[model samples]
Structures are given as C-alpha cells and as structure tokens.
Target chain A: MHIATRMKTRTQGGITEVLVLVNHPMDTGLVKSPITHKIIPAHFIKTLTIAINHKPAVITDMGIAVSKDPLIAVKLKGAKSGDLVSVDWIDNEGMTGHAETHVS
Target chain B: MNLPRRTFLKQAFSGTALAVAAGAGLLRPTQALARTWPTWPAQSFHIKHWRDLEHSLFGSKPVVSGGVHLHAPLEAENGAVVPMVISTKLAAPKRLALAVDHNPYALATLVNLTPHALGFFNVRIKMGKTSRVRAYVETADRVHTVDRLVKVTIGGCGG
Candidate 1:
C-alpha cells in the first residue's frame, strides 16, 4: 500500500498537539486479489512512532482489525508550534515508511 | 352410491383438520427476514463492515462526546478513493479507530496514538457505496463513537 503523511501542531495547556495523516491500504485479509481470486493475506502497518526532535513522543502498535489508510493525532510535551516532528512506521510485512511535519 | 358417502365424510374431516393446523402457530411465517446484516468472521473488511455506532470493535465500547469529530465528502466521485478525517478535542486520548459500513469487510482502519500526542488524524478510505463512517475513541477509561455518512457514486473494492 502507498503511504503519505501530514502533521499539524497546536498548543493547549502548555502542551503541543501533533496531528498526522497516513495513506495506506491496511488490507485486513478480507479483500480478494483479482488475479488469484484468493484472499489477500493480511498486511498492514503494525507499529507507529512519533518523535519530537528525535525524542520519543508517542508509539502505537496496531493490528489487522484497523481500517485502510489510518490517520492518527497525538499530544506531546516540551514541543512548541513550528518545531519539527518526525514520524516512522513499520508494517506487518516488514515494510517501513517515514514522514515529517512542522509543529504549528 | 352407498359406499361413497363414508369416503366423502372422511375426506371432509381431514381437510378441515389440515386447515386448522395451517392457521395455528405450528407453521412458520411465510415472509422471513433476510439475514444480510454485517458479521465479522476473522476481523477483516470482506466479512463485516465496521460500525462505531454499534460498538463492535475489539476491546472497546461506543460513547458519544463532543471531543470526537469525523469528516468526509458528502458525495464521492470514486469509491476506490474517499478522503476522510477524524479529530478530537480531548485533553489526553489513548486510542482512535475508523470503520466503514457497506464495504465487503467493515473494519477499515485503527490508529493508536502516543501518550503525549494531540487527538487528530486524517486518511483516505475505500468505499463500496453510500456507507457510514464511524470514529472510535478510547479515553477517560471509556470508549466513545462519532459517525458520519458518505455517499459513493463509483463502486470500489473491485465491484
């Protein structure tokens, strides 16, 4: 599945909120492959990590039960709007994708 | 002619009994409801469509609150790709999930957020037709749901 991400930042109560959007198929082992006429094996991003300035901000572990092209939002401390936040994710099939956003 | 009278009486009696049996509760209803409701056999898109309103996800319950917001196009030109967004106003959220009804399998995606992250997300989804998009949120030791409808003009999922 093709993946892409975008992030937005806002401040509340002295904390920065980081929002993210990711593009992916996240096939849940139910869709059939047209050529094979067989169920496409479950392959999806199982883990997602958000780091602010290379520090661990958030980590998420997912399963096949999730929807396609999942979107995630998070809140972090010590980061302000207009700061750089990095995101990295790994799927069950061992494929990895990364993205970055300026906190705003 | 004498032999025919007994046969006719017996036939009449049996017919009356059969009619009575048919009218009583012993017979099943003539019009049975179809069982087309969604079902999840193996937690996939083809078996059951995800519904946040129904609270059918694993390890989560459905709640309604102002913190959860879901956005999608009122009408989609292509079911193959529909844009969607889910945002929350909660202070600290633990988990977020999205489900689509009308696809072969309903549970479309799940997003787990970090402890120190804002509650906002955006993504693209595949739709089969006009379906309900549900957002599931876990916070304050409970689960909540917010839903919106999306209409698809073109068939997706290889339909």
Candidate 2:
C-alpha cells in the first residue's frame, strides 16, 4: 500500500537525465509465496508519468514483466539544472506514489 | 532566469499545441491526464506472441527496420532482472514499446513521449526463457523496430 521512490538527476550540455527507482513487489501472479506456497496476486505499477517543471514529458505503461523495485530513466532535452523533475505512478490496485526533486 | 522558457511551456501546454491536439481529436478522450497522454494499451500486454503483440499494439506487423535500437545482453545470466535500454534515431518518435517473444506476456513496457522529451529509456525486465526481445518505435507515418536474442540461463516466471 505504501510505495517509496528515489530520484536522481543530472544535467549536461542541454539534456537533463532523470533516474527513478520505485519500491514495489512487482509480483507476476505466477510467483508463489515462499511461506504460503500459493501463487501471489499480480501487483505492479501500470502507469508511470514523468514531468519536467510541471509539464508531462514521458509516460510509461508497464506490466508485471518489469523487474522488482523498478528502475526507470528518462531524458529531457530542454530541462535545465534547476527545473523540477517529478514522478507519479499508479499501480493496478489503485495505489499511487509521487516524488519530485530539482534537477541537479 | 528560467521564467521565460517556463512561461512559454506553460502557454504551449495550456492553450496552443496540446489544446490543438485535443481539439483536433488526436488525443484519446479516455485518458485521465486531461492532456495528449496515451491510454494504456491493456490488450497488448496480454498477448503471448510477437506477431500478435505487434498487431495489437500497432494495428499491423511492422517490417523489421533500422533507427530503433535495443540494448540487452546477448545472454542474460539472471532472468529475474535483465537490464535493457532502448533508443531511436528518428527525429520524432511518438511511441515505443518492448516485447519478449517467449514470455507468457510478451509486452514488457510501452512508452509515450511528449515533445519535450527524447526517445530514450532504460529499464529492467523479467524474462521467462531464452527469447527474442523486440523494441518498436513509432513515428508520424512509420513504425521502426529491432530485436535481439537474449538467452536466459534460469527462467524467471516460475518463481
């Protein structure tokens, strides 16, 4: 129910690179619980949006095939060092996570 | 210092460019973002075959073409977490997707890039077995794609 995110940004020349790591089980529904020995329900981020300075730059539609603790990177052409890079994601179960940081 | 460019972007998002796209019915009405963002291609993810996935996502099978690059290991030591990077050489890449031919669900991820962003992405995915991984990029009128074979030593789907 609770998702944690970490974001790092770097700017060189005129491009700003943003990398985000999201905390999630990314269960494939085929994976069985080690304790219960039952197939875990599918739980993964479905829609992830990256915004640069409040303008949506990239949107990712993901599935259970993504690795656990998903790491995503995006590049913005005109984003500068002080621009704000934000990430917002919603999972299949309707849970959401948000994190933002200034590009550095 | 950034106020002028920020103001221009604000104007573009609020009134001119995106609004025109929406007014021209180019943007999907179902998107909750109230902008030109693409709706999740839910059916594409459920497909199991490469041909079907291409059909479901793009309406037809795109010919294997250049300009789209997929960076993945020739042999993935661990199927649980295989790092992949995809980029396009086209001037304007509208949509990009990655699919694994052998996985139960072939579609890995779909990306829609706005005008402000570049056509490059880095992520990791799970593979069921040794399979052909394909990356597709869509331009205004053409869809370019490329694929690579990634051998998984241990399958990742069975837990």
Candidate 3:
C-alpha cells in the first residue's frame, strides 16, 4: 500500500468539499510488454471509501477504466477546521491505502 | 509504512475471495446511500462494447440527445489522462457516467451527485485509443446522453 495521496478540504455555507488525488499506475492489464509482448494481468483499484469524521460518505468501485492516478472529489456537510476526513481504498490486487486530514 | 510481505499476500488472497463473491452477486454494499445511487453490476465493468454498457445502465437503451454537453479535446496527446467535463441543461441531474467505446472495458466513471452539489462534473480519464467517449446522465425520470470522439496519438493502456 505505497499510495501517496493529497487531500484538500474547504467549507462554505455549511457544505464541505474534499478533493482527493491518488497515485497509482491503474494498470488495465490490456497493454503488452514491449519486450515480452504479453498481456499484463488486470490489476486496478476495486473499491474506494471516503469518510467524514469516520462516517462513510463516498464508496466507489472502479476498474481499469479509471485513469492512472485517479482523482476523487467528494462534497459533504460542512465541518470545522479540526474535523476529520479520511479516504481508504483497496485495489484489485487487494493492496489497501488510507489517508486522513483535518479541514483547513 | 507498507505492509509486510506476508500480510500483503494475505490481503491479496482475501481480496480475491471478495471479488469472487461479488462475481457471484453476493458482495452487495449494505449502505443505504449506495442503494439509492445506482452502480453497475460487478461484471458489467468488463463489457467490451459501448452498446452493451448502455443496455446495462439505461435499462432499455440510451437515446442520443442534445440536452447534455461533453467538453473534451478533439485530440489528446497523452492517452493516459484525457481531461473532460460534463454539464447538462436538464433539470437536476442525479447521476453521470462515462464510457469509452474502444477501451478494453467501456464503462468508466459513474458519478452520483449529492443533492447540495450542482450537476457539473469534471474528470480526467484514460483512453485506450482513438474512440468515442459517451456521457450518460440520469435526471428525475429519464436518462440523456451525448458523445465526443477524441484521437489519442499515444496509447495509454499500459504499454
């Protein structure tokens, strides 16, 4: 789970918006190795869960259709600067990544 | 820190088991929100053709309409990340989904908009080749669609 994620949270008019960007190859398993010319096995993030103050808000199950290093943006009820927002994801390979932040 | 090698293997194995359960249609999400916001069937993600995807998502079939607008490039330099935006004149769109005709799996992102959020969504997605990118939008009662063709000079499916 060597995922590097960046999150920015902003609140306006009782609405909190969180933007999350993840770093992953998102390998589709459709491309071939230039040298070996073999179809790489399909491996991509299968599920992503987002929580506001530890309450699940957004849950996404993605496949190879997602681009490499996917972007996920979520909107929820407004939270104070110290409120917690977290994102957790598990890929098709079963590797998982988690990150959390307090609103700025 | 990354997980230990043994733990990684264990997680991977369990993931495979979960996938198998999903494949058997036993891996349904228990949350109420997911139930309200529609999601594609687990296997439908691998559909190779756009028409099949339409049938799966739209129930009957999606009609070509001008109610929605797709903002995407006529040509993309990097197939790995082709930027796109979607908007609709239709009143209060509830969900938006993207599908690539030429990609190995046609269905891409399926976005469910919160009631408070406006019906505008922007995303950067992968293109396997030069293909038609279709956007499907669901409103209160019906679904509307529009598509744009983009040329990918460089392939992005992992080669």
Candidate 4:
C-alpha cells in the first residue's frame, strides 16, 4: 500500500480516543539539485479525511509544511471497539492514499 | 567593522575564525559553513487582522475566543512542517479551519465536521515562515477561535 497507517482505539469512561500515524514522504519541495539549483516543486498531501462507519468525521487541509510521516490523535466519545475507521489523503500532485482499520 | 576588540577576539577565537582564516588565504572557504537562505513566497501574504482572515475564509468575523483550545509547539524546528491540533467543547461543529497569518495561503483547511469528532482533531501543516496559527470552529450557533505563535528556525523552509 502506498500509505501505511498505525491506529488504535481505547475506551475509557465512555470516551474513545483515536491515535493515527501515517507513513509518507510528505515532501515539501524544498530540496533541489546542488548543481541545477531549481526549486523542488512542493509535493505534499493536501487533503486528509477521517471517517467512522463511512461517515466523515474530521477533514483537514494540509500544507507543504507538514513533516514526513504525520501523527494525528482524536478523541471520539461514542465510538466502540468494532467501528470501522478510515483515513484517506490526497497529495498536491493528485496521488491518493488510503487505509482503514477497526477500533479496538 | 563596528565590532569591539573583545567581540572580534571572541569571534576570532570562536567559529568565525574560519572566515577570518579564509581572508588570510590560510584556507579556502568550506561548504561546512555555507549559508542556507530561506525564501518566502514571491507574493507577500497580507491580511490586516485575524477577522480579515476569518472574513476571507469563512465569510464573517468570528466571536471572541471561547471553548476552543489549540495545541501547538511554541517553537518549530522546521518551518516546512508543523504539528497542529484543535479541541473544543462544542456539541456539533459545522466546520473548522486553520490559518497561518503570514503564509502565502493563510487558510490551510476548512473541514465540514461530523458529530463524531467529539471535539478533538489533529493535523500537521506547513509554515512558510514564523507566524501565528489560528484555529476557527463554527458550530450550529456561533464561531470560536484560538491562536498561538509558532516560531521557526532560519532557513527551515528547505534552504
């Protein structure tokens, strides 16, 4: 998979906390050839969608500034152990990446 | 040239000695001490106020800050990538957005929310330079905002 996700869900006092870490280069287009000195056109994720049970939960727009392999943490009050949580991202170059896992 | 003798002596004793040594032709300037220059976008980012940013991004100015907490680092090691999080006590938000006041595009993202958020959200955004990041959230009733300054290291935009 182009995107690998690590996620976990824990329920405590009726609140479910979701932790996410996505693996990607998140290239900010800042690096260029030492010889040519051309700008390394920024290539990074633009949109990130978090959905629970196929319903959109949180949607974020990313900038060229996000670091490689981003981390996201959220707390969902009513989510359970079996609900399906999906994360999807679209890069600036239009390349899309996605991954899904169950809350446990 | 305006440096005091003690300062010059300190630099001469410290790292600037190489630049001094280069002047004497004792050594060639090395890449180890090469300078890295940061470049802001050619077009300047201009916004008169946070309300202006809100008006441009969300159509109307927001209410005073309440119920929303923005978590971010006080200082960022790199300007290109910064970590951000927004948490709130609102029941059901209609949308939320993040903005860096000095970025080429201040409005980073505005997401239509679901009741599922339970008021906590996280994401990472890039900062072209050091600036205040404001998080605005619109619920069924009103809008709330929270902001903080995030300092950046020089030449961090991949100079």
Instruction: List candidate 2 stretches off by more than 4 Å.
Output: B1-39, B60-62
The DockQ of predicted model 3 stands at 0.34
Ranking by TM-score: 2, 3, 4, 1
Tens digits of lDDT, candidate 4, A13-95: 87877777878777656577577888667766666767788666776656554567778776766788788877666666666
lDDT of 1 by residue, A1-104 (tens): 45676666677777876666667677767578889999988777666677777554666555454446666656577677667787777676766666776766
Worst 10 residues of 2 chain B by lDDT: B26-35
Query: Which tens-of-lDDT digit does each residue in B1-159 have in candidate 3?
Result: 899999999999999999897776533332322334334357778788888887877776446587888899999998888987777667677777888999888888776664544455566788879999998888877788999999999977763
**What is the fnat of model 3 with respect to the true interface contacts?**
0.29
Model 3 misplaced stretches (Cα beyond 4 Å): A12-16, A74-82, B1-40, B61-67, B88-92, B114-118
- Rank ordering of all candidates by lDDT, starting from the highest: 2, 3, 4, 1
Alpha carbon lDDT of each predicted model: 0.65, 0.85, 0.74, 0.68
Residue B90 displacement (Å), model 1: 2.5
Error of 1 at B68 (Å): 1.8
Write model 2 residue lDDT over B80-124, tens digit each, in one string.
899999998689889889999888888999999999889999999
Indicate the residue-level lDDT of B38 in model 2. 57
Estimate candidate 3's alpha-carbon lDDT, on a 0 to 1 scale.
0.74
Model 1, C-alpha of B159: deviation from truth (Å):
9.9
TM-score of chain A of each: 0.82, 0.93, 0.89, 0.81
**Candidate 2 local lDDT, A10-51, one digit each (tens):** 888998888999989888888888899888999998888998
The superposed Cα distance between candidate 4 and the true structure at residue A43, in angstroms, equals 1.9
Number of the top lDDT candidate: 2
- On DockQ, the leading prediction is 2
Tens-digit lDDT string for candidate 1 (B1-159): 465988999989999999997776233221110111112223433336354324454445446655688888989888766777777877678777777776655665555566656676665667777988787777866776778888888866642
**TM-score of each prediction:** 0.59, 0.84, 0.73, 0.70
